[model samples]
Target: MKDQSNSNNDPIYYQEATTLAKLIRNKEISSVEVVQAHLDRIAEINPRINGVVTLMGEQALKSAALADKAVSSGEELGPLHGVPFSIKDAIDTAGVPTKRGSKIFEDFIPEKDATVVTRMKNAGAIPLMKTNIPEFSAHWESDNLVTGRSLNPWNPDRTPGGSSGGESAVIAAGLSPIGLGSDVAISLRGPAAFTGISALKATHGRVPYTGHFPQALSRFWHIGPMARTVRDVALGYSIINGADGIDGYGIFAKDAAPATFRIPGQKIRVGWVSDTAFGPVDPEITTAIKATAKLLADVGCDVAEVRLPFMENTDWLTPYFNLVYGELVPYMQQYTRGRESELHFIGKATMDYPLLNAAEYVKAEATIEKLRMHFAGYFQEYDVLLCPVNPMTATGHGLNEYIVDGKTVSAYHVMTATAPFNMTGLPALSVPVRLSSETLPINIQLVSRWFDEATILALGEKIQTGSEAYGKHPIN
Candidate 1:
């Protein structure tokens, strides 16, 4: 750990938070310098990234003062002692504006921190600011009227990926060391892939979703950590985990698998995805997949091209969309019925959901059940399923539709990999592995059984071990 004589010397912000915590614990630095350095970093980089919209400079400084006092007086320090952290705008922070990336409620401030936020604070993580998100937390794009769009630090014209896009933006840009992001589907992973950062969407119910947006209000969403490294992801999860006691869909936390965290005798069997699964991905993305497969195989993993129905049931896409649109109908209607001046045009798309007839709902339910059964059959053979979190790096910003190499498609098309897992309630992760041809970060990863996040993350940790530049610097 660096001493206070040069506590804030690290040019890389990703290392700042953990280093700050270590310094404070070892009396090499005070909490105040750590907090101020982060605040200063936010002021420096956030303008370009827009990752942090609402700054808590004053509150963060105050918290740092208290934490240092405690440290000096020999009081106990939590796991995240005096480390500064940012919350995705979708998550509540007491008295802080969490606009959920829409103009309709841009000024909405909550009276209490979301349960996840509260738990993180209880661990002594300093509240630096709230990051950005997409409107109503819909779509994978993180931009909304509230804070505009969070641009990719790698290339400003490209998007950072959505929903949790802002969180990825900040971490990738080195604006904040770590932040919270809720993933309904590929929200976290999309940006993680595009930004080349570490993130994990824990099994639903393992992480509480209380006090967040409509996505968190429902059962099909999860809140997880976005960080520059796997250890950081594990640290963030270790803090905010367990039941928050408010979300009705949130069950009590489960016991940890084992202290050793090593599958002593079992060979890692990962079903790899080659060129054709869940729609065509960019060749760059596929190249990363093949490279990863080779690495795993070289490392003694039983890696082979095993196709497990990722795109076997394209006929069911409409039904899945119906289920999604149905679940989001109320929120869509609320914004749609809202005054045009009060809402963004995207929210208007959601407004028409109420008009769907009874037949549509019935068909959607049947399709979902069948899809779930089909996916369950795939898991019977493979312990883990490797795939893309997104097909390419972050796409162009502000374009409702995407045109990939002369092929036009809906903006939502990129999210195919993630949504299917959510549809089946399977646990998935998007681990940052390598950068794309454009030098944008690519997240290469896999999914496991419903409650088997440990296996997915275990493999992610292994893959991350081979990536030297994955978290080199969000800032040039």
Candidate 2:
């Protein structure tokens, strides 16, 4: 890991996507310039971080040139006009290799873009590159047979949180201004927390999951925006959200147009939790959660420490893992049956996941409904539930277990704070609040009721305002 504090000297690379759009629209900077700068930054920084796996420099530059031409013609521009953004390899990109972090589909390239990618392109954001991920996106660390592992930008020895780790690492290092990432359990929030960036996993169906790899786990899957700033995340989410008429889950997505900016008229009610359900939270992380509650209260919001009994008593993880592995294990077996030796550590471990019987699976589904009702009941009283994104800060790469708060905990325990939201299909946003004693970032997960992204995003913006993590890049 090179300690190039001046690696992020170029202001263009660090500017938010929202700012880049304005700069390009106002002719202060050309789209080509911005695109080229990001591509150059990727060239310089990607080798050390291994975040971006495939580059589209030539295609991106051509697209940028066309964008510049469109500007010259004074044509109508979209909200993200002339901005460059990245896509996770698990998502399809037309004519670009989306390897999905697996050797099986290493050469696979989709002829059509995913719904989210199409929406972003239509909004005038150019696809820059594909980021790394855990093989089949089934692991906690972003290592795979196809692209190896994505290292944390904060410290190369540590692992960036999995699946969307590459997206978080690049955004945190200023290689890309904004990007798209998918979340199953903690893919979006955990990585964003690990890298000191902001990510939004909107209500499950708020964004379509069409064309994403391993389509088996679509029930718990969500695709959303990841960026360094809340405003940029809001901008990206606004463009990519809503039913696309393709995904089954998308068809039932509630209309967010009316409530896009609807902040609660009353004093915002915030409930903070630290150690009730989420096991073995770091002491520094608990302090940060309390500090965040104070921050909310100081801002005149009705903030209090509260616990959800359902969370404490019920086993959310069993049902979540049952559903996840129920679909994913079989899907993975088809590809790894004959060539298991080619599998990466995470990929091989995924194969060992136990599959539930029909009765057990049906029971798991019922439990999910029960959990949803529990959250719905709680939300009727409180507008937001704030908690730690992960029990510990970013950990060193390739560890199967972690010692958090002096207790040895399984690697899957980190997902304790994040998986419940995925099961309930609620809107959750990860915002960096403070740094740990080791200078690692500590993020607070703000979850809102179904289709109530506005509440969490509004709260995220307020939390972001006081965050030292904002505008501070790890590479710098």
Candidate 3:
């Protein structure tokens, strides 16, 4: 396998994506060279991480050459001019296979680019490769029959987090400085936290999701930026957010950005809650999150232990799942019913949700509405809230089920902190917080009010500095 060291010996690999974009603008380095560095990194490490499944190296180089021509000709530069990025397999790319990490669509190449993909290209970001994901982008883990499981770059023995697992793994390993990830609830944020990358889920409807498969029908799905640093995420967000002809949601404004990616100075109101209106957290994860809250307190942030009354029971979680997974049955029955051999086990699991009777649907929606209101009230006073992304860090892949703390759990129990946000449509992020006992990366989640994603990234940056995931390179 080729190595990154040959191509990426300079400090450019460590620079923020935005910083590299400027270097391209100034003609200090050509986009072609940058693309080569990323391709080399992917070759050297991707076999182990399994992050990128479909490489567009030739296409990327072609794009980079064109970018060089533009610069040499003194053309006006786009916001992300000459930067390289990848996409979760779930997002479509013109003439490229977007398998959504399923065997069923391994041969499926799209005739058109997803809305965000088109936008990124227009902004001059070179398309690098297609990252991996679970089948149909259903489960939280990045394992499917087609591409296999994505291992954490930090430790091969652990998982990288999913369905944006490939996106997270690639960024954490320093392959591509930034990439796109879709999150119905926690896909973008969860994997970021697990892999120790920086990411932003963005406000609901901030970025268009028009060519994203499966979540195409999802009202709550969001396609946003995932990168190694908060500033990189912001730069990507600027490039990707825009109205698409097919999307009902209007394009996001280019003007909005937080003053800083990391919070600065005087104590801001911060709230900490280990348990939630969802499932229980793993003791290790819980302790790590609480410790982070305390760390922030030491940094002079006004930290308080807060609670959301609605999270005290599980009555709402079942329906929330039913509404999401329940809706999938119809799509699969139409798309995959006669084609079972084309699907993975989790795709079958997703199809099983609609089997729930109308009684189940009624119950799920009723509880979801109440839970949404209950949590909305909590945002009245807090600037941001912190919690565990999942009860546990990345675990072994391919288990049909898990035995969490000795109790038999459903396949979906691990996504405890994630799905509830889908129910409420509130923006949240899983910020890498601290190292665990095994020396793996563990993350704390931050949830902000509707349209308040700026605060989430700002606070996440502060935590990143303290955790040391900010400057530490996985390949180093």
Candidate 4:
């Protein structure tokens, strides 16, 4: 597809949120014009990708009219004034149905917006629609009985990774400029990589988790931004990063500052890892990650190969799953007390696991702390860690195993590379690096210390600006 992003006369569908905001604020484009452009884009593309499950066309245009009035009335405008963004169906949107990709909550509509959604609106972003997600966001692809499957714009046969799959897909397909998504595992980063976009999983509590489903796992879960560029992700992060006083996890980290992008003048210490102890990566993905490292090195960053202790096992998988089931299963059981049969199959299976006792839970928590400290020490020497977002690129839908180097492994293996950072509650940013021979996009993840999202974002922006693959649009 020819790139529409650089077409100045075109309607605002493919423009970056940051760019759209500037045009709207300066009266180059009315907010109504911008919203209509996206609505028309959705009309054309949503049938194929199914990325936007529930559109707010009437509501969005109404809001856009008021936004234009404000702009013409000489009222102060926020940074994202008049830009339209989508929310993952898993997050609440006041008066909008948040089905969360399950029949159980198909009719459920929230009376209040999620903290992140409200922040976006407060910063002058308009809600365009509720994007699709997996059942309770527990799967690898964004498919559910409620909203069906969200297809990858790059290749319909492949999945846009979940639970932020729809968010990533819509942004990549040019239906929306920016989006809100949450991640406990690889939801945010995986989908961004799969769709060839950018996303950030800020430190655990940096973005409040209020008004999201299955709120029991707040420690590891995070809500953040998915966009077409690293700077836009940073823009969204700056607006949403803060304590909302409702989520205790968010309240504890009141001092954490938002990260921004700046080209580095001096050499930045970067630690690079291509393969973890868990298994081998797709050779092409490894090559792409190393190429990214060399790109950073070419820009004067000091890059070196590094390994972590117990990385062969990567304590994140087993113990993290244990804690997840231990805390979440009971909560899910109680939440679906009367509607168990309507729950998604994955949700039902999650409740079937025998719950871990208090001691086991503590042991799992301790293991996570140990992993955190190990990374804390590692960050003492390195500014950021560059790694692959997934061992392999986006694959065909509904498969339960991945063939890596001719060996079959559980499909969940993709989470091995990303879940570790979630376990450590660190900030990790994923940006597209290169496309494989199959023409699918691959990304390298940059991870920083507990609250140092700035360093990682800066490095990610450097890689993004220097790579030719940056901002390459997928076929719609």
What clash count does candidate 1 reach?
A: 4
For candidate 4, write residues 265-363 as lDDT tens digits.
746789888766435788888887888889888988898988766687554688888988788877777667888777666677667877778898899
Off by over 4 Å in 1: 1-12, 215-217, 256-264, 313-317, 332-338, 353-355, 403-407
- For residues 1-476, could you state the per-residue lDDT of candidate 3 as single tens digits? 11222123535555567877888999999999888888888888899899988999998999899999999999999888988988999999999998878777889999999988988888888889899898888888888988888988878877787889999999888788889998875688788877877677766667887888885446778888998777678677767765665677645564544333234564566788875644456677877777878877887778898877767765555676677776777766777867887677778777766457888778777888887787667766666778878766667666656665456666566677777777787778767666667666677788877677766777777777776344665565
Judged by lDDT relative to the true structure, which candidate is superior, 3 or 4?
4
TM-score (C-alpha) between model 3 and the true structure: 0.89
TM-score per candidate, in order?
0.91, 0.95, 0.89, 0.95
Q: Ten-residue segment with the worst summed lDDT in candidate 3?
A: 1-10
Least accurate 10 contiguous residues by lDDT in model 1: 1-10
The top-ranked prediction according to lDDT is 2
Backbone Cα, N, C clashes tallied per candidate: 4, 0, 4, 0
Regions of candidate 3 where Cα sits further than 4 Å from its true position: 1-14, 215-217, 249-267, 276-279, 295-300, 400-411
Clashing pairs in 4: none
Please write out the lDDT profile of model 1 over residues 18-68, one tens digit for every residue.
665787888887778777877777888788878877889899899999999
Q: How close is candidate 2 to the true structure, as a TM-score?
A: 0.95
lDDT for each of the candidates? 0.75, 0.87, 0.77, 0.86
Instruction: Give stretches of model 2 more than 4 Å off.
Output: 1-10, 252-254, 257-265
How big is the positional error of residue 400 in model 4, measured in Å on the Cα after superposition? 1.0
Candidate 1 residue pairs that clash: 140-162, 141-162, 142-162, 193-443
